[model samples]
Target: MQAQIEILASLQTVDREIREQTGRKQRLLEDLRVTERQIQAKKGEIDALSAAWSEREKLRVEKDRVFQDEGKKAMDKRMRMSRIKNAKELQALQREIELMRLGNGELEEELIKIMQEIDAIRAQIQTKESEMAAMQEEWQKKQDELQVEINGIDAAVSEASTRRQTIASQVTGDLISRYELIFSRRGGTAVVEVAGGICQGCYMNVPPQLWNEIIRNEKVHLCPSCQRILFVKPATE
Candidate 1:
């Protein structure tokens, strides 16, 4: 019973370490997820800007074509005016030329505005793309480091689990099963010492007989309050 109690104690130590490692791994994974989400958000911003820039570029091209067509029409009308035989026909042609010229001027202004907008959009795209690149590099480094840490944690957890199994095997089957149940129920604290006639697992007072049984170390005893396995440390140890 003394040796069994010692094995249970050792098993508890390993189990606690395993739980801690598991928790650390989970936290690291959550951090990695958050970082990835941020990276995606940055990419989304760049993609939206890129789409806008593309649309603006298309509009600019179409406007330039329209401007060129209007200029050609104006020039053609001026050439036809040189062959006019009537004053009224000449005046009408002149009026048409003036209207076309005015329309072309407005188109020119619109084209200039579109060009300015395109330049602004391009600049924004450039800045955002650069920012995204830097953000990705930074996040990738953090992710790599986190992955390494997670791997270390995994290795530690595996080792602790193996150690737990080895220590648990030295204990009785029924005791080991009960310890597991109590460990889960008691928040990873399945075994605890009796101190000052109190159950250290819950700080509850232990009955005199129970305390004596724990002192005897004859068999596994459970705390009445918390149901955790009770043990007593050797005075020398």
Candidate 2:
């Protein structure tokens, strides 16, 4: 029975190692997840900026086309003035040409403004793209580092699990099940050592008779307070 208790203790140690490593694996995975999200967010921002740039470019093209068409119409009106023989008709044509020129001036100003806006949008797109590229490079590096750590943790957990299986085979099935239940419920400490008549699991005082029975090492004994399997280390010379 004492030997069985020692086996349970060894199993508990392996289980603790596995649990800690698994937790580290989860944290590493979450870190990778967060890094990936940041990179994706940067990409999304760059895409939106590019879309705006494209829209501005299209607007500039349309505005320039309109300005050119209006200028051509103004030139045609000027040519018509030379064909008119009547003086009043010529004066009227002159006024019509002047109005078209004024309208063209306003359109030209608008086209200039559109071109400036397009230039600014293009510069902004370039800057954002550069930023996204840097973020991707860093993200990849972080991902590689985390993947290596995750792989190491997986290997460690596998090794610990194999050892735990070997140790657990030495104990009875019912005892192993009970220990596992206690291990989970008690936060990875299913077996505890009693020293000076104290229940180490819960730090409560063990009854005198129970302490004596525990010392006999005849069968399994549990701390009344924490219900964990209890044992005492053999006295050393």
Instruction: Give the runs in model 2 whose Cα sits over 4 Å from its true position.
Output: 196-227, 234-237
lDDT of 1 by residue, 10-98 (tens): 88999999988998889888987887888788889888988988898899999999999999999999999999999999999999999
* Residue pairs of candidate 2 with colliding backbone atoms: none
lDDT of 1: 0.89
In terms of TM-score, how similar is model 1 to the real structure?
Answer: 0.83
**Poorly placed runs, candidate 1 (over 4 Å):** 205-219, 234-237
lDDT of 2 by residue, 1-237 (tens): 888999999999999999999989888889878878887887788788778878878888888888889888888888888799999999998988889888888988888887888788788778878887887788789888988888899999999989988999999859999999999999999999999999888999999999999999988899998999999999888
Cα misplacement distance, residue 158 of candidate 1 (Å) = 3.4
Look at candidate 1 and give me any clashing residue pairs.
Answer: none
